[model samples]
Target: MGPSITDVPKSVLQDVIIKLPTKSIIMCKSVCKTWYSLISDPAFAKLHFAQAEAYPMVRPVDRRSVSRNLYLVEPEDSSGFDLKDHDCNRSRVHMNLSKYKLPVCHPEELLNYHRNGIVMPSHETERKVSMKITQIDDNNNEVDLGDGFAFMMQYDHNSYNLVNSCNGLLCLSYFFGNRPAAVCNPITGEFINLPHGPKHEKAMTLIGSGLGFSPRTNEYKVMRILKEQTPDTNKVAEIHTLGTGSWKSVGTARCSDSELSFPTCVKGMLYWFCDKWSGCSVISFDLDTEEFQSVPSLPFEDGYDVSMGDLGGSLCLCKVESFEINVWVMNDSGPQKLWMKKISIHTGFSRSWPRGVYIPMKYFENDGLLMFNSRLNAFFYHHPGNHSPFIYLKLREIKYSSSEAISHVPSFISLKDILVGKDVEILNINSRCAVLKLPGETEALSLVEENASF
Candidate 1:
């Protein structure tokens, strides 16, 4: 070698390191003190996060208590993370389950089995789905792990629910607003508590909430929807800026439901599934302009269970019909072709549509796989083709009533800087390793058991 990497200039090294994937950058922190200091700098994190891509993020619930652990799924090929703007019309699947047959099981039976911490024998018949999970406990201030691992951050003593994900930051709120909500960077463990929404005289109830980032102003904002107990059942929306430390009245909401569907943030706008007297439609809110608009709804008339999500920077809806699922997407190009059919997945199991079905979460283009979760609190990757195979990833032994994984990009954007003088607590995530064996895999992968916090 002509010269060592250490001999490289600081500016050149920083430039090269920032281009690597988030997992590679995290490993760079251990090279030496100089590299650690350079990588840990706030400026470097901001620059690197800008270039990062969002991946499937899951927080496995621990029935004993709340969990603060986060899992980031990375594909074998880094380019597989590029779910947006790809030209591949077909995909090649990795897990070989051509001979494997999916067992016929209903959603109710799966849910009941999961509730009792029992794994159905049918789910164990095939080992087509597999992932390598590693658990690491870091004494350092930052969370550092090798490939195919998760990011960790500490949370408070109470339990919190993940409202939505925006620009690498997760919006967390207490169940039914028992306590204030917060926005946090799970990687850095820096967060700021938000004040409750504007108080109202007419008994108000929390309906919905979400967090988003404003690209125009470079600010993070939180929104809350409250329904007043009046004859008309009026609803009001409020906005809260991070650094400003206060809430502002936006306007009346058009939704009439006491509890609206979960919201998804895509490209700085928030979208929610709204039920109207006419039919089902999607409502969108702009973080920059502070305006709400109605987007097109699904084509079906009724009796289909649907879940809305942000798939590859576009608004995606997945509806279940018997054993088949329809994936529809709203293109951002123009108004002429608003919603169109993207893909159709046949589960291959001949059974009646259960209470809960497969809901598309995120897509991996290079891998030709679509990642989604079922109401049974498990995640599966679907590869659309003649045979339509699915690979399942196990999150731990924790039992949950329902589970969902959001498209989240891991970043180091600090809340301390975003909130300036506000109280931002830096936390330490507790970590431990467990064992999980797949149906046919030779080697077993480690599972992550993380402590609770938001």
Candidate 2:
């Protein structure tokens, strides 16, 4: 390399690094400490993220080659690559479900757009005594969600629920009995309490709750839907705006015996399935207006075993039938009739694993690969283009009984940066953490003297 190129200025170097593919950036981080410092900086990360957002066309993954060697980028060019797609708190609600010998995927971990597939291999069931969160990154590599995140919540792993996710923020509810909710940036492990809404004299099963962001108002919100049974079912709506302390009433809606799955937020609006006596309809609540309306219903019949998910960046509904799961993506959000049946995946009986249900955890819109787990420690990537073969991906290290993976987007935005009016505190994890401090942060906030060294 010539001296001019070798001696590239820091500003010029920043552009070069930002231009590299996501995997290359991680590789470049190890080239030298200077490169690591530059690439890992919060400001640089935000700039790189903005650049990636500007080019949003996701490219599909290649089936012929599973190795990183055949890595594909946008426009089918790896040179000027555009590899598409794809936290926390402590007091860690580390749920180790290995002892039960049952499937332990949590619907609550579905907190964001790029849902992470949490897994614990079947072999290592002993780690439940010391629970750990296993998360899969974009490169198909697994990362642990350690630090006091689970412990900070002070709840048994079974009681924690991931409410909603936007941009990169996550809302989690703790409910061994109490229904206290909190919003936190899993990357930075910075969280603030959301004021408790209408108190319950006795513990009750919450209908569901969601977290969202309103770009127009520049605010984040936590919406909880409470249901009471025994005396005919009735539903109550309560909302808490981030940066604001208390939750306010959003009025109430009549409840039905039919099932309503968790909410998925899109463009500042929250949507959930409303299975009423009338029919199955998708009910949406505008975050900015705080108004509720029924826009559209599922394309299928009322009770067809349906589940909602974020397919890539679009809102998707998955209909699970006998052995095939039909995935429908809402191509155009403007009209209710624009649902395009993108793909159908066959999950029929197999000689090796019969009757094991494989659920899609992360949908790679660009590459057409749907990541899933049929059982504990068992993970596979299903490419819709090719149905006959399923590519197996393995999770190494940290084997507990239960594990969770949700769609996650790594970001430079800190909790303090988003929560403008509120005070922020970092949870002290009683365990060791691999990554500490928010990206671009100096001196770890609330530095626990013993475990400060990352």
Candidate 3:
């Protein structure tokens, strides 16, 4: 028998809600009037929300493959976790490209040939191209899941310019001369254009732009910061929220003389290292409340400043001095704890932290890898490994530094190529791809054999 409401302890009731998933807790309110009242209370809701925040979701690391060559050479056991006495040594794997009918290219040569930081356009065109996302098996061959399925925005031949990709969506800023800037999801091809605000003569002076999703209200927001030229010498800031279709002034923009960097969204908040007109401060924007708050100033000695980076799903402040690099993870509220750990003090290009490099705007590859361009070197940081020591995978080398004009390159590969091995009794292709499985089928051999011909 259930205990009476008067006999049940409030602490026990709070524990029950806290242990349940956020979705389940909301559904519990429908069970009874007392349960509804308890769950509907703002204070109780806030408490549960806080608990959820405390336990941020951690994705399981796929122990399948690590590198391209490794995946091909030994498709199975590619995780490298089973390799005993595997120290932090930079080791290269050898593979015969010709074995898998792959192009005969040296690992280093292939790495140098490709242009690194280019955002693959979401739009489709005559020549379709696809990039490898995850190595499903260790065969060293890619399971090219059609270009659009993995991309965040619709593939547009024209109109789409990738600024940067963060989390799952890409931060795209369109330049139609006098047209307003538009942010979009490359995978789903959904986009929201920012509204034109007070016209400024010098829009070129703008330094940073960013987009973030608020799960609480299911809304996406974009923020832009521009350095204004005037006798007053004060920075200006503007923000735009999708569906509203108008730019709203936030506050006096404050940023350093150095190129302004975009805000980093961490733990449901947008944080920016800014030099406010009054003084330099780390400003944080709360997505839930849409309010701005200031963080404690960074402690630096001898005028040395620290740059911010994302560390293990948290906002990190990085300090580099000669050969030593220190990464500090922010723990604003906890057991009065702030974790300051040293990632490496090694000497070489390998020691350079790629996550700290600022890209205009970028999206997080489906697997949480960051793709960006710095000078001639295209850089990628795959987050499958330890977050601090970001694996700096080179994408491509830039041949020319011409005008930064936007161009679209579509994937030539068909959607049919991606669904090769997966079991599909009923395959439906329309605007989006869907697969239906048949009962009593242990495996789908015919589909795998047909795709193998490709």
Q: Best candidate, lDDT-wise? A: 1
Task: By TM-score, rank the candidates, best first.
Answer: 1, 2, 3
lDDT of each: 0.59, 0.49, 0.39
After superposition, the stretches of candidate 1 with alpha carbons farther than 4 Å from their true spots are: 1-5, 9-24, 76-157, 178-180, 275-278, 335-337, 352-357, 385-388, 396-403, 420-454
lDDT of 1: 0.59
Residue-wise lDDT of candidate 1 within 26-118, one digit each (tens)? 678898888999988998888887776666666544323234445566543444432232243223322211110111112233344456665
Q: What order do candidates take by lDDT, descending?
A: 1, 2, 3
Q: Compute each candidate's TM-score over C-alphas.
A: 0.71, 0.62, 0.44
- At residue 138, what lDDT does model 2 achieve? 20
In model 1, pairs of residues that clash are 155-453
Q: Considering lDDT, which of the candidate structures 1 and 2 is the better prediction for this target?
A: 1
Best by TM-score: 1
lDDT of 3 by residue, 129-209 (tens): 344322121112334445574342122212233343344333554322212255432222233334456665543345566
Q: Under the 3 Å rule for N, CA and C atoms, how many clashes does model 2 have?
A: 37
Cα lDDT of candidate 2 equals: 0.49
Name the runs in model 2 displaced over 4 angstroms.
Answer: 1-7, 16-45, 51-159, 177-180, 200-205, 254-260, 273-281, 302-305, 347-367, 374-377, 384-388, 394-398, 423-454
- Residue 317 of model 3, lDDT score: 59
